[model samples]
Target: MELEGDLFSLTNLRNMEIIDINTGAKLGFIKDLKINCEEHKIISIILPSQTFKISLFGKNEDIEIPWDNVKKIGVDVILVDGKNLVEE
Candidate 1:
């Protein structure tokens, strides 16, 4: 089966950089996603870990950005509220 929407595949989104709409700072690249299995919806986006060693060890302190914070989804970057959404 296939899916369709204004948003493209998750593959396309993985490499896309996440940016803060308020600060205009590049947060990081999306590394994974948190899903609500019951609803079959994306709950949040997980950003790459800060430390390389931790990421290498497969213990990522991934920054999670709630889907509600997403303001815009562009071709190259996803705009979100850094002030509140980004879980540091």
Candidate 2:
């Protein structure tokens, strides 16, 4: 469920950057989303996988930021506390 009076458009969300507060890293942009249709809640935000030479041999996996990890949503960035839970 959406927080009371808290609403955001997917297009705007996609336009904002995701920044990690702990490491001050620009993890990446929001690539996609995982949502819970039955519950009407967002599960997580997806980010493109980190670049690696290993991808030449295997498929790259994208990163996910749980909804609970999101700390703030600003005009240009989404502040997150993913920390070590997310790699730079």
Candidate 3:
């Protein structure tokens, strides 16, 4: 996916899913992306929840997966190493 130019452009990133490589489980959708200010590279991914938990204070938390853990980026999903993902 060629994500260049306008950062807010949702043309290429609507309804994309992020998956766990080890188990092939659907983690969440791509809510937004954080880019590094100096290097201009993607620093982390944002995953807004489709469901909510009361313990989380009723606010959606974005799952910040560091760029280094990303194993691959696929057409429909972004895959990451499962061992590094935090469990609930």
Candidate 4:
């Protein structure tokens, strides 16, 4: 299904939650984006920090989600298939 709405700005995407469609798990909020400047396209979405927990340490490895895995963009959350993502 195609999503319909006004174009989303980076600021708008920042406020959205990312969910894994395969397991219905909350991934995390987007912390950064990787763009292919030469191709003028988004390469991946970068998620920082842990999901739903406060880590004792100040850092956890960032999760890099390839753009191809993204399935949908809803009003509140972004749906993605993360089953194939490599575990860090």
| TM-score leader | 4
- Candidates in order have lDDT scores of 0.77, 0.80, 0.64, 0.82
Better of 1 and 2 by lDDT: 2
Kindly list the per-residue Cα lDDT of model 1 for residues 3-88, writing each as its tens digit: 23375788988878888889888888988899999999989998865555454556756688888888888777788886765444
TM-score of candidate 4 against the unseen true structure? 0.81
Error of 2 at 45 (Å): 0.5
* CA RMSD of each candidate after superposition: 5.0, 3.5, 4.6, 3.4
Residue pairs clashing in model 1 are none
Model 3's TM-score against the true structure: 0.67
> Clashing residue pairs, candidate 4?
none
Question: How far off is residue 72 in model 4, in Å?
Answer: 0.4
Give the distance in Å from residue 52's predicted Cα in candidate 3 to where it truly belongs: 1.9
What does the lDDT read for residue 45 in candidate 1?
90
Whichever of 1 and 4 has more lDDT, that candidate is 4
Q: Give per-model TM-scores.
A: 0.76, 0.80, 0.67, 0.81
Residue 48, candidate 3: C-alpha displacement in angstroms: 2.2
Candidate 1 accuracy as lDDT: 0.77
The sequence of per-residue lDDT tens digits that candidate 2 reaches over residues 1-88 is: 2232267899989998988889888988999989999999998998887665345557567788888898888877898887646532
Residues 1-88, model 3: lDDT tens digits: 3323334435445466778778888887776777888997877776665356445566664566666777766566667765665322
What's model 4's lDDT at 86? Answer: 45
Q: After superposition, how far is residue 58 of candidate 3 from its true place, in Å?
A: 3.7
